[model samples]
Target: MKNIKIVSLTACLAWMLSLMLFSSCSNDDANAENSGGGPVIESVMPSGYNVDGSMKPLTPVTLVDPKNYYVIHGKGLLTTQKVYFNDFDTYFRPTFVTDTDIIILVDENTPFADASNQLKVVTANGTAIFDLTVAPPVPTFSGFNLINAVEGDEVTIKGKYFLDPVVTLAKTATEPEVPITIVSSSLEQIVVKIPANANHRNLAVTNISGTAVSKEAIGTALYDDKLYGMQWGGPWSGKGVNFDFDGDSYQGEKSWQWVFGGWDGGNWGFDVDMTPYKAMRIAVKGTKNGQVNFSVNGGSNYVIPVTTTWVYIEIPLSALGNPASVTMLTFQESNNDGGNTVLFDDIGFVLK
Candidate 1:
């Protein structure tokens, strides 16, 4: 009986000692897991952060061994974290990559709390924290087209990243695109004034940071000058008044012309010749009774009445017997009784 009691007491003491040792080891392991030096940050959120770039905060911060650890914050143990640049206020989900790297994407439009341009990193354990400098996104431009034009007319230009962009004309040695004052800016479109006398060719968009030129494109071009034909001397000059003949006032005395086969003073009823250039534009101003006939082939047969004042008449080269060799245009009239005087101006020919 005495032996049994001593053996039982000894067994009980051994069991208590083993339990104490196991408990100490377990505590040490737990402390090791929660050490101040948390998991290493492999990489940061947003590969390349730019000044105009955005961010999203409080997102998941993945860990290399995420299954083995948890994240912490003011509230409690968290599975993810939100981090961003100092001046950026965007939100991001921090994802753990490896012992040395993590991935994150900041919410757009959020200014970082700091301008130092630092990328923040939080460990999965929530105790380890660090920062890595991030770079802002580079500005770029694409697609440029000319607007509202024919050859020789000025037009506006359309494209991307036009706000505060360095505008320049491509392939042109002299003509360059000036800077466009952007009233608004976006990711897809930009409106601006291009150089005058622009031609279809390549164009360039640039900034202090970089330059972006377009693939060869066609643009509106400008034209040269226009040409006009010369004026010819005729009875119905293209003007409102004619000075080839003297005055013919029925009550007033005739100056230096004859009237109706009767000598008054001087040359009165006269005819002039026109060159062969297809057609003649005739302008005449005269009294209602001042009748005149257009004769072709040098003969007096068919006559047309001239009654309208300051009226424009077009006589075709074909009417005169299709005179392939027309030379002179004669006007004949017999004023038995006249009412008022007549006038003419600006008789000329235009090239077809």
Candidate 2:
């Protein structure tokens, strides 16, 4: 009798537990099916660790960051079929969904410009909309310069993610950022009026995500309109290369335009110490995509592939045999794609 009673008790406990689980699932399913009312979003909260690693409580944000997860707090979300950030169709997992909350990751490809600026949720019963802004990733501050720039000359900044950008120039490291006038802006380029106060300081571009600072500053170019401390180099006007006399430029009036034949090349002469610099930088584009062998002091060639669009690249000095002095800055056509014209500007070096 004792053994029989024990078995009965065990069975009874198992039945109770199963009944409770069924009831819980049933309640959730019922809530999800009760779609007579539409979904609503009360607030959106960021997920995960903070940048500072502080224990400060997380708060709701009006901005949705790309590549980050966020929680949607509201009712009627258990049966949510879709969520859109900035009208972008974002993917979410159903197992993570619930009636009052949803954990979803914002896709990195979500549009940050020219969008509805909305966070929408569609459920079985209805849909809900929340006002939210999608922020672009941190801006990339490749380089900026103005050829023969005076106090009010237009300076062109090159990089990525210039959406709703704010441009500032700091005369020194300790000084506050001074706002500059913007002439025009695109996703990867910006033209701003150079302030008189600009000096050997830093330039920064800020967007919703964060700021990107320049690796160098104004009045620091190796070749801006003219070379600084440059001895002599290049096609030398009818010798091997020429300027864009027609006025197509990467920044200012014109850039170095080279139309090469097969195996054509040119060299720039410089008698200056390069120990203070970290890399060789330039903004270049080609009429036809091709490659060139760039060398310093006739070191091992650093092959640079050029595209049709203007692109700024910084090649570390170490890549070119780490020459301590600038003797020969050479460019030789190696594309073998017949020959093509390439435009160059913002020729310079970056500080260590």
C-alpha RMSD between model 2 and the true structure: 10.9
Query: Mind giving the per-residue lDDT tens digits that candidate 2 earns over 1-352?
Result: 0001112334334433543454366556655564567888878876543445432133688987777667777677878998999888999878667676776778889998888999999988888999999888899976676633558888888999999999998545468789989999999999999888675556889987888888766755766554566577665233547654445666555678788877788888887578667888888888888888888887899988889998888999889888888888888887887777887787877766
Clashes of 1: 58
Model 1 CA deviation exceeding 4 Å by range: 1-118, 124-164, 171-184, 207-210, 215-352
Q: What is candidate 2's TM-score against the reference? A: 0.65
lDDT of 2 at 103: 67
Model number with the top TM-score: 2
> Which regions in candidate 2 have their CA more than 4 angstroms from the true location?
1-36, 49-58, 145-148, 170-174, 224-238, 245-345
Residue 190 of model 2: what lDDT?
96
TM-score of 1: 0.27
Model 1 C-alpha lDDT per residue in residues 1-352, reported as the tens digit of each score: 0001112334334433543453355445643554545443322322221234332232333221110111222211123354444545434333222222333334334332234544444435563343433322233443333322234333334443343455555535555554434443443455445445444444566643346665323321110011112123323322222333434311111211112221111112222233425554444445554655555556444344555445655556556565554345455443445333444333433222
